[model samples]
Target: MPHADTLTVVHHDDTRTSYTDVRYQLHRDGIRIWSDEGEHALTDILMTHAYRQREARAS
Candidate 1:
């Protein structure tokens, strides 16, 4: 797991790259909010859920 206040690079094999800043916790759920433009909330939510689903399978 990444440490608090760290940055993680997000990328896609096809063609995409992004940098996510680990912001504060989301109500102690250990869910960290990635620093990004709030205007992109829809995309953020979708991407986050997809990532979490993949992690679940890997685990």
Candidate 2:
């Protein structure tokens, strides 16, 4: 069965004029599995996670 997963935006900075800094965390079964911080939108983060999962399953 798939693990129960949760995505959370732990930090966000909108003060920059060029881009926003978004920090995110991914938790599986109530434990942190991954986390990253960068100038990325929420959709970008989600898509990245999806891509990683797909690649993992393929390999």
Candidate 3:
């Protein structure tokens, strides 16, 4: 089992024939933080995390 506070990514391919129909869900402690079907979803999440970390260090 994953840790309670662990961030997890659940991915699904809506169409087996192509990679364009993809979905992503971001969860923490079994609760969803956000979900997106766009191709840039993972990149957006990663960048957001990086931005938060940088802000935390600056404070």
Per-model lDDT? 0.32, 0.28, 0.27
Q: Give the TM-score of candidate 3.
A: 0.17
Cα TM-score per model: 0.21, 0.17, 0.17
- Candidate 2 vs candidate 3: the lDDT winner is 2
Kindly list the per-residue Cα lDDT of model 2 for residues 1-59, writing each as its tens digit: 12213333332342222222222334442222223343233322222221222222321
Name the regions of candidate 1 deviating beyond 4 angstroms: 1-13, 22-36, 39-59
Per-candidate total of colliding backbone pairs: 0, 0, 0
Clashing pairs in 2: none
Model 2 reaches what TM-score against the true structure?
0.17
What is residue 6's positional error in candidate 2, in angstroms? 19
The local distance difference test score of model 2 is 0.28
User: Per-residue lDDT for 1-59 in model 3, tens only?
Assistant: 11122233333432222222123244542222322333333322221111111112211
| Segments of candidate 2 deviating more than 4 angstroms | 1-20, 29-59
What C-alpha RMSD separates each model from the true structure? 10.6, 10.5, 11.9
Ranked by lDDT from best down, the candidates are 1, 2, 3
